[model samples]
Target chain A: MAETSRDAKRARTAQLILEAAREEFATRGFDGATIRGIAAAAAVDPSLVIQHYGSKAALFAVAVQLPSNNADVAADHLLEVLAVRLGELPPETRALVRSMLTVPEAEASMRQFLDERVENLAGSFDGDDAKLQALLAVSGILGLTITQHFLKLRAFDDVSSESLLEAAGGWLAPAKGDT
Target chain B: MAETSRDAKRARTAQLILEAAREEFATRGFDGATIRGIAAAAAVDPSLVIQHYGSKAALFAVAVQLPSNNADVAADHLLEVLAVRLGELPPETRALVRSMLTVPEAEASMRQFLDERVENLAGSFDGDDAKLQALLAVSGILGLTITQHFLKLRAFDDVSSESLLEAAGGWLAPAKGDT
Candidate 1:
């Protein structure tokens, strides 16, 4: 079946809102960001932001999602892709991360991202300690953000991403399920 | 050497101001925290708080220092102690961390602690990627705080500290200096 122009237009508008929300959340943090401001930035109605995502918290969850992933990507490969994607997050997305950290309003939204975006990956690991494993992975990434991204620790800046990931090799592995 | 009574009283007053500052900084964040408020909490004159430490930022640096350590503890044991200490941070110190994240005045103070406390440990690591190694360790700890402490991931709360630390085995090695 041929796709309708209306469907394409709808998708485009949603994408616009997501991008705008990213900017708003990053710059102002969750407390300072508003639906109206994001709507204005996207050139869409404020209701549309709410209509599509339901609430501010909902909007943030969708806005910070990783780029689409292949369902077929192996578990191990998925981890690599996730790590690289986390490291190379767009500036807006990174801002959203800091916003989540600093703002109280974003707490639920941050948890939503961890559950929807991060926990699914944790489950794929051969582990019963899925939540623990997932949190650990996030810990490494968050720590790296502090060093490699936010603080720009000189030693981390000097190392290639590949070498850094290689070093992260042992740490990234999910704990075995039975254990 | 024998200590003078005046010196002892001076030290006691300084300690009182520090305890008061920790509570103020934690509960109110840097922007909301005031020298007068801290002094009131300590039952001292506001000028005394200033006279003792010079400023709030300098005060925070001294108050949040980890208990104590020397080279005598094995590297692995040190890691355990460090993790435990981070886990069991005083309420005031934890509050100070949130304040640091949210307020500019607190950031410089926070950096002082990170430099005096965290980066020194980073520098002690052996390899060229010492900074990165230290950060990875921090990342894991930060992530754990978000889950176990911040968000209250119940599964994480259920796990014993020992098991959780064991699960974090590979990621926590702070590259041994000169190894």
Candidate 2:
């Protein structure tokens, strides 16, 4: 009985640490954020954070793991992905995207994630430039997601994701001439 | 003669500080970067940095100003902008983009810049969704810049900006059914 309660308490503390870590990472990026800062924000001792998460890199990995979408990157799948991403971005994903360029760990994670997506998407198109086309399409969607979700451009506030996708149909359709 | 040499020396010092400021801002972003760090990087006193640039906010503004494009957002103009942006993102612009979401000042600057461009592009399109279409197109280009330049995705290294632009034709063209 005591062990069960203790396990529950540990899980709760870990969850608390994760929430604080996400906020710190999202605000400061990986390089600027510290375990101590996260611990303080979580209202726990610094050592307790290390105890719960192992290391800063490990914590970041666990914190920023985006929910994987297993579907292939078809037109419908792309729209679905954009719809979710264009709305409020998950704070963890925001932390990863925000820090991807400046921080090595974040960059590695993002590169791995994006490479897989680009590969999956490139296979959908035909031609010598298929990979590049896939990349351009994916990159464009990423930009829209950043504008709406991260940058919060006021001009986009009135526009629906459906409307944006409709406007994007040309890009999402098979590369011009391939069809 | 002494006064003229002093003026030259002062200008040199200011230029050095600006270069250092750009590197610091690029690496750490706006919120993470410190005036002290910029000074140290420039081999100047913190007070000297303040004397030269006034404040961090003022320094950032001076450092990150992109070379203004005077042309309208026509297809040719859009391609020209993308060519420059995709080739190599200026460190200052990278700093602004990297920090835009997390830092209020960067966000304000980026919002102002993008809003003006969206307005200009929207006027060229014909329909209720013109502004939204403009925003999506601009956002996609921004995303491409981030992927190729900032993120340094290895997959994009082989792809020329010309090819990428060609793949992006559908995006840069006026929205379908608008013509």
Candidate 1 Cα misplacement greater than 4 A, ranges: A1-88, A116-118, A166-179, B1-7, B64-87, B91-96, B99-135, B173-179
Give the DockQ (C-alpha) for candidate 2. Answer: 0.56
Candidate 1 residue-pair clash tally: 4
DockQ of predicted candidate 1? 0.30
Model 1: how far is A98 from its true place, Å?
A: 2.5
lDDT of 1 by residue, A62-156 (tens): 66655444565434453443344356646455655655555554555555545443455565666556666665665555555554544444455
Tell how far residue A124 is off in model 1, in angstroms: 1.5
Docking class of 1: acceptable
Off by over 4 Å in 2: A27-46, A67-86, A168-170, A175-179, B1-5, B31-46, B67-86, B175-179
Clashing pairs in 1: A139-B139, A143-B139, B126-B176, B126-B177
lDDT score at residue B166, model 1, on the 0-100 scale: 65
Candidate 1, position B87, lDDT: 65
Best by DockQ: 2
The interface root-mean-square deviations, each candidate in sequence, come to: 3.1, 2.1
Candidate 1 chain A, which ten residues in sequence have the lowest lDDT sum? A170-179
